[model samples]
Target chain A: MWYHIDPSSGTPIYRQLVEQVQQAVASGVLRAGDRLPSVRDLAVELAVNPNTVAKAYQELERAGVIETPRGKGSFIADRDHTVTEEERLRQFIEAADKLVADAYRLRIGSERAAALFAERLAEAERRRSGE
Target chain B: MSDVAIRLAGLTKRYGEKVALSAVEMVVPTGSFSALLGPNGAGKTTLIRCLTGMIRPDGGAGTVLGVPVGPGYPPTALKSRIGYVAQTQALPERMTAQELIGLCRGVQPRWNDAIVKRYLDLFALPMKQVVRQMSGGMKSQLALTLVMGGQPELLILDEPTMGLDPKNRHQYLQVLLADSIETGCTVLLSSHDLHQIERLADRATILVGGRVAVSGAIDDLKADEKRVRIAGAVEEAVVLGVEGVRRAVKEPGGWLLFVSGASEGLVERLRGLPGVTGVQVFSQSLEEIFLSYA
Candidate 1:
């Protein structure tokens, strides 16, 4: 199983599963064409309601992260050029909001937050290009 | 099949001058796994009993699987379609698992031997062991197996995993999850196991003082209800003025505002409040939310 859910977490379980699958896809742990477990199978394995698992799969499908061709099961989508610039910015802004919120909570000044964000972005870009 | 599995309106039960249930209203849709939450003496058991037809309600009416359930309404016809497991099961001590299964099969109108066999085998319950000698976990397994034999459309379970170890409890819940998925059965579970309920139940009803304090789809409840932390001293009146702010409590550094319907827009409004250095929003877990109502 590549996904685990924390029921006690503030995040809802389906959303948690959604994030886990998204993270796995981003990290290259679950590559395109990898077959994900069926909703029933995953629910049984996780001891969660099957509806919850189905909701996660539905969200993934809507996001174009996974494709479920009828009778063939669900597989990670091949997204070599599917991502739009608008979509990219939308996702980035959602993440940046959390980063900003955390920075405020930690009392980190705007300068420090900007510097840390730039440093991490440079490292991520370097790793992505195999520099 | 009707869309609703259970519907109770003005459900009231009283015991000798003491009210067990006070005009409780609840609705459980078909195929939904719902958890009934309440503190001790909060009428959880009385409500279950009323729905199961074991006890009569002084007021209100209910329907189970479209069958009317209330005073003067015998649940005889409905009983065959419902499986009930009380918190403290009263299985005959001398009867072995096989014997109980045989007895149930003889009496149940919709008994399915295969389901019983499958559940007992999956749980590895000793069929020959007498009820008195079996472990608490095994007894629970046996009780669940016998109940499943009827292929019930609605399963009413009361603290079904009370004394079992964590592993056994997980096994029991897994079987239920699979069963519900396979059959689309509606389940009304009454238990104090918030963690398990949080994972298993999609809808929840929190009862306080024999009345429903909160009830909704668990996902919606968790999404809409949140706790916001203010960095500095803030006026309670001002915090309460924010849209959807239900309650406010003072904390060490600031005020913890319990806000319902605190979606992104509402949260931004909270952040813009005066005398607030930082505003952190935390979604309340089921246990935390239940405590607020319990």
Candidate 2:
């Protein structure tokens, strides 16, 4: 319910919810035992169709991100959902493709791009180590 | 669910020399939220009137909720089950919202008082205020509330949020969507607000010159229609020769090729073309698609 769904964005509403729930799970914000808002409650809160919310919940259930029990309600599934290697590679490739395209446009040398990548990695590592 | 809420077959109408409708045909599915999009004088109002039995078409025939529609006008039974909140709707100036609600309630056998109370509470509209004293937005919302209170099977709203501010519009649409979800109301809302349509509607029918220009699931249309920017020395003619290409514009660096509901592999095919050094495929938003035919 805390998540926001931008109606103007090209992305579908149900997909937005799916991604938000996944992100929250990945960020440790939504624990395995946390209960998601009921379909009606979330629909009213989000100002979206209950069918859209229901579809999102159904997708999340199919993906093992949540569980819906009969006579009760839906809750986060008790499973460790990790990002697949294929998905990570796809993300990295998409980022790299865009970077390469921009570099080609700006005539940036490969050496400069490599050095920039390394510098950013070191900065991220330093932050991770509390530096 | 497959049964249509409204259907028109080669429906045509003319006012003097002007053609209000030209072979206008469309289908609004039961329990589905559909956006009827068109510019001014695009026969949107004419079509609505024909469906509501308020006006007789010059040619063709149609049906609303399985009731036949024609020149003589629709049956009273069919009219009662459908709710239509016209853009030009007017309320009695001296009547209070409460008083008017009472008057309207007397005519509707299936009217729900709870819905009236709930909508009044949501909009915070004073029940005692005369309609003429209300703002345009307030009057629009009041009319919609009155129509919706009847809990009709099919609801047609003609730009019901035209005068509402962004916040008010969002709230009003939210309430409407919630009601639709709860009651499975079949809604056909004609509005130029593409943002609202994109958010709330799953399907649409774009009208151009009183004819259906585009109609289908919104997502499929988005996927099919894309602006492909490819940087290469490839011949524009050859690329335009490719199937599904709607428009091809030659830019300094490349060509912006618009593919209309093209297959997914078309972009990949363009990427594989010789001299295609850089390619960018831009998926169109609903507004862009609407503008293309509008």
Candidate 3:
């Protein structure tokens, strides 16, 4: 799976991997049964510790986002019968709350912050539609 | 998660007449980002070499990720799992950056071409330029690229930012920090760049004269050593004699004191001292603390 990481950010590595994989799955960039790189391979590619990659994979597996076959490799799991929309929404809201809190701490006012977030969402949608 | 990636107990090393490392004990938690910091001749490099299995320890037996580190340890299998980047420029002069990385990919069990390309691009590295023609900073970056592209379970870097310009150093550390964050890979880097260490490391071990002067979480060390400024004609000796003071330096018209296990009470004590006008608790920069050790 393709991934990018920022070292200066306060977010931990495993969390970044988990979030990226989740986003990829949600966006259908990673389809059901799509074979992702092995933990070792991904670790090398990302210049990260193998254990760190393993932790991310483990978390994804626990979330039913990926499956691993012994001696084979990890692959995207079928999302059709996995997490429901309500659960997904719950997770999304939780993340949004954290973002809002961070923004609040940075002294971004509510109205402007909401407008900025909407702008970002629209930009993301446009990019997704290849506009 | 509790599995130890590296364990060293009573580890010692010497070079001819000088003791480089003396009875050092350390445990690098699995998937933790740990830094070793020390002044010149403080044995940081020697400790790093021992941990990487490049040199044998004199007085201790330990395991690096369950493989015995001394003689009779599984050779290639264990060695392959470790990525080591030394302070010195060690890349072959004839090979270009791309060629060198490609060579590593061929031998390493785990290699990521995409990751390698991304790092090269991010660092603005010249892929086709020969190592001999590269600048010092470029060579250092190339060395780092080689090790990072290998993607070992444990990373041991000895002053990886040395010889790099400020911009290159920032880029290098950014990549290094990103790798640690994204991979949860265990990292043991030795650097005199205290600010970088403070920014990147989860925990740190300070080596002084071949011994562990201090070892703990970075936050813990910073909290323990409170910077106290006493504005008065205080004698350096008297300030140093304060119960909690670890070190004291005479500044213009005052004394800057580094007190271990500092608290509000300690500040009050300093303020109450004879000839003291103002006593304030300040944060000690990592550089200041490192220099104190020296």
Off by over 4 Å in 1: A81-83, A96-131, B231-238, B241-243, B268-277
CA error at residue B151 for candidate 3, angstroms: 1.5
Kindly list the per-residue Cα lDDT of model 3 for residues B1-294, writing each as its tens digit. 447888888889988888999989888887788888888898888888887767887788788888877885548887777888878888889988878987999998888887788788888898888999998888878887787777888898887887788876766776776676677668898887765665567677889999988787665666676677789988877888778998887888898887888787888788888999998787665566666676
Model 1 Cα lDDT, one tens digit per residue, B57-131: 998878889988755665577778899999998899999998998899988999998898799789888888899
Scored by Cα lDDT, where does model 3 land? 0.78
RMSD of each: 3.0, 4.0, 10.3
Best by lDDT: 1
Misplaced by over 4 Å in model 3 are: A1-131, B1-3, B231-242, B248-256, B269-278
**lDDT of candidate 1 at residue B196, scale 0 to 100:** 91
What's model 3's lDDT at B247?
80
* Candidate 2 structure quality by residue, lDDT tens digits, B1-294: 437888889999999999888897788888888889988888899888888878899998788888778755778787778999989767888989999899889999899999999999999999999988999899988998899888899999999998899889878988888788788889998998887787778788888888888887676777677778889899978788777777788899889887786766787778888888987877677888887777
**Arranged by DockQ, best first:** 1, 2, 3
Give the CA lDDT, 0 to 100, for residue A12 in model 2.
72
lDDT of all predictions: 0.88, 0.83, 0.78
| Native contact fraction, candidates in order | 0.75, 0.33, 0.00
Q: Each candidate: how many clashes?
A: 0, 0, 4
- Chain A fold similarity by TM-score, each prediction: 0.76, 0.62, 0.65
Instruction: Give the candidates in order of TM-score, highest first.
Output: 1, 2, 3
* TM-score of model number 2, chain B: 0.91
